[model samples]
Target chain A: MRYEEFKEGIRDGIPICLGYISVSVAFGMTAVLSGIPVWAAVLISLTNVTSAGQFAGINLLVAQGTYLELALTTLIINIRYFLMSLSVSQKVEENMGMGKRLATAFGITDEIFAVSMQRKKRLSAPYMAGLILTPVLGWTGGTLIGATATSLMPPILSASLGIALYGMFIAIIIPPARIHRSVLYAVLLAVAASCCFYYLPGLKKLSGGWSIIIITVAVSALMAWKFPVSPEDEEDE
Target chain B: MEQIRIGYLLGGIAVMAAVTYIIRMLPMAIFRKKIDNVFIQSFLYYVPYTVLGAMTFPAIFYSTQSVPPAAAGCAAAVVLAYRGKGLLIVAVGAAAAVFAVQLLMNIIIV
Candidate 1:
């Protein structure tokens, strides 16, 4: 049973691997373009497995930003994953120990958490191992392809494909937004809050990391206040 | 351009990986018991959508060369995603739309 569940996790990770390739290709190109070593680029993907945080870290590194700044920026940008894991932690198999839980948490990217949460029961070790395996392979593998293929890749192609990662982001939210009016409203609120943070004369000076923190927390808080989802509303992801 | 010092680069990655990993690990490892708090549950439930949205818009609008192609790509994604296409298909659709528009725009400019 555990093996089957593990296999299912790997099976579900297929599309995510594809999406990771498209996005990580851009990151690989960006890292090399920024003059980062290919090994470092791949290492970032291997260790971090985060898109926004890696991008932000790379940008800061290129600009020779302070170490404190870089770390804080990464923390803030990847903060959402904390929430993701918190939710997933609740759903982790009760028998699972701290070690295995930590191992599973290492794999808790946004998509992984979402799919795992959709499971009807507490997540099992085999299932999580299977789920995380392909995407980890995909993430590092894509980075390798990107970092090495730097010379052959056309600038235009890389730029055009940059949209693919964002496209995946669209895939995540749109269905929920469409099916749930509250989600739609939360999305709109997030966008509106983001725009204000971007454009408002006084607020515009806030850094990207800080703004993301604000937008995520504020919009979620407001939605929770106004919408107040019942236990069932939050059911099955 | 001056390159980032090698030590700093490694340190930065370590910091990022450590912090990001810790942030993820702490919750998953420590939260052995379930939270019965309603507000926190509701708040956590909405966090994913809000974060995705906060990342997408405004950022997506400028991800490409200009608004026209980027808009084309995003519109394709939104439409296809709304229609329930798989993520892989949606991403391909968006990238292809942007590529097509960019090609035409290049031709027009030249």
Candidate 2:
């Protein structure tokens, strides 16, 4: 039974694995361009297994920001995983032991969590292991390829690829923004607040990491109070 | 460009990895019931989008070697994304747009 579920998990993870390669390739290139070495970039992907949080963390690393900023930014950006973990915990087999829970939770990325949550039956440890392993391989492997390839690429091509991360960010928020007015409002407000942080005289002094945290917190709180999301208001993605 | 010391990078990676693990593990290990707070739930629901929005803009405008191609790429991404294109399509399409613009500008300038 465990073997069969593990096979099923691997099958379900295939699409996610394919999707992660492209994003992680972008991540790898971005990290290399930011002066991170190839092996370190791969290490970041292997260990973190996150997208936005890694990107934000890497930016802070490049800036040589204090460790406090790194920790706080990671906490705020990845807090959504807490919600997914809670939901997935309910779906997991009853009385799952701490070791299995800890092992499975380490792989609770947005994609992994989403796919795991869709299963009708309780998630088995082996299934979770298979599911998590496939994508981590893709993510880390893609990063390795991209980071090593960066030195070979021409300046023009590398420059063009610079926007890939932002493009993915757009892809993430736009579909939801279209579905819900409140999401759109929250995103727009966040953008405006971000601009204030960037262009305003005094605010411009705030570091990029802090600005993101402040803007994300204030804008999200305002939206939560003003237009509380209904249970049905979740994004399809 | 400044060289990133391996030690600092490793430390930063450790911090990020640790925080990520703790966030994911705590609820699964401890929480047996759903979070019943509407405000917290709503806040979590919007956090990802809000954070992405803040990070993408302004930064995206300066992603490329210059602003014009970056703007072109951003516009292409928004249009394709708004049309419900997949993530790969939007991302590659934006890069393609930036490349095309840069190529065109190179030809014109020459």
Model 1 stretches with alpha carbons more than 4 Å out? A59-66, A114-122, B1-9
For residues A1-237, write the lDDT of model 1, one tens digit per residue: 877898888887886787687678778888988888999999999999988789888998888888888778888778778778887887777879888998898989877776675566678989999889898888888888888997555767766887887887898789888888999999998988888887789998887767887888888888888888777766654
lDDT of 1 by residue, B15-90 (tens): 8899999889988877898777888777877887887788788889888888899999999999999999877788
lDDT of 2 at B70: 97
Name the top TM-score candidate: 1
Instruction: Tell me the tens digit of each residue's lDDT in model 2 across A1-237.
Output: 889989988887775676677668778988999888888899989999998889998899999998999999898778767766766776677767779999999999766765675465778888998999898999999889878886455779878877876887787788878977888999999999988899999999877766887887798889989999765554243
lDDT for B20 in candidate 2 is 92
Location of the lowest summed lDDT over 10 successive residues in candidate 2 chain A: A228-237
Q: What is the model-wide C-alpha lDDT for candidate 1? A: 0.83
Q: Tens-digit lDDT track for model 2 on B50-99? A: 77788887899998889999999999999999999876688889999999
lDDT of 2: 0.83
